[model samples]
Target: MREVVRAASLLIVLCSAFISSALAAGRILPHAPQIAFVSAFNNSANLYLLDIRHGALRPLTQLPSLQRGPVWSNDGLRLVYESNAGNNNINLFMIDVRGGPSAERQLTYFSFDEVEALFMPNRGQTPEGFVFTTVRGPNGDIFMLDVPPVGENNRPEL
Candidate 1:
């Protein structure tokens, strides 16, 4: 009887520890909306949030667009993707990685817009910001923009 009681106590203690740890993490995740995108239907991509607690899925983008590649910001607060939404060419857009519609902010708009900014981890962020390549006449040019602090949006400081 004593051995059985000890086993039961150990089980209860372990279970309690797990429950508390889970609850603490749950409370902290909502602040970011936690999201991931997947192919929901034919030729379309949709984002879903893992409830983490219930394992429930939530929809993000609904309209059909050639969505592929998910890139996260250094801070993990933003996601950049390529999609066919208004422009005929591939464009770069940023979104809140957490959840919701997370409207994309277009990074470039051109007749043959190509997102030249995303270079993955290898493309080191310079003292300014991201180094970019833009077409000029028949040749392509390389440029750099210093990363600015929040609330300082203006034409690239060049």
Candidate 2:
């Protein structure tokens, strides 16, 4: 009975922490009324969209990897986030919110972790893409990746 009680207590504490963190990390889209967030309610952390007015919840990602730092594009048509999908190192990925899971595209392929991604505003003399930090050494390096144009074959340029 004591062991059961301890386990339940620990679960409650963990669940509370998770909920708090998720709520704190929620980001509202710039051009839309929906908010993007990460949640582990389905056992694995994945991106989700919450309709602010209607209170509708939609899961954006269903992969068995941890997704974090969801940032909306300038136009709010897409989202960029970090995910540890293929390996232990986290990489940046972009997905069209309306395109569903199939629209997800891996942005960085480095062995080190890339995180804290955000889309750059389209302005004079500024390229269109997102900026992210790469954890390579003692200090994290910031990089700006240009958005690749989709080729005629319907694939992103490498």
Candidate 3:
């Protein structure tokens, strides 16, 4: 009976260890997805992900310039931010928070110089999307960048 009890305790311990390791391995850079507001306008403002698993900071943009005024996607899977670099163009860019390569391949082009961006959900049968604000003289106008749903299995779809 003592041997049997010892064997059961050993089995439980091994199972617990295996479960812990499995959970650890499954945790990638982000155990939970995060988006941050950065100071890229003057002091190297860029979006950063607080990777809980790696315990490190990850920048969303690959650009060598400054970025700011980030707007996260409706589903919280992606972000679109503004970058100026003291140039005439203030381009919009999108990146994934999960820290892999950005699924969308192109940077959004705006004819007007942009200053900030935001995303609003279409909660009442409106099909959610995003909005961006760009400076036109002293006034800034907010515009929409409509996008299709990620579709089907929707694992935190963005």
TM for every model, in the order presented, reads 0.49, 0.76, 0.56
| C-alpha root-mean-square deviation, candidate 2 | 9.4
Q: Supply the TM-score for candidate 2.
A: 0.76
Question: Per-residue alpha-carbon lDDT of model 1 for 38-149, expressed as tens digits?
Answer: 4435545554444333345555456576554454555655555555677566655556655444254555455554444543342554433444565555777665544344
TM-score of decoy 1: 0.49
Model 3, position 112: C-alpha lDDT score: 62
Q: What lDDT does each candidate get? A: 0.48, 0.74, 0.53
Off by over 4 Å in 3: 1-35, 39-43, 52-54, 85-87, 104-107, 124-127, 148-158
Between which residue pairs do clashes occur in model 2? Answer: none
The Cα error of candidate 1 at residue 35, in Å, is 6.4
In terms of lDDT, the poorest run of 10 residues in model 1 is 21-30
Higher-scoring candidate on lDDT, 2 or 3: 2
Q: Write model 2 residue lDDT over 21-70, tens digit each, in one string.
A: 45436787755667788887656788888765455678888898889899
- Pairs clashing in candidate 3? 39-45, 40-45
Summed backbone clashes in each candidate are: 6, 0, 2
lDDT of 2 at 68: 87
Off by over 4 Å in 2: 1-24, 100-102, 124-127, 151-158
Write the residue-wise lDDT of candidate 3 on 7-66 in tens digits.
445445534654532311011122243325452323354555544333355656545576
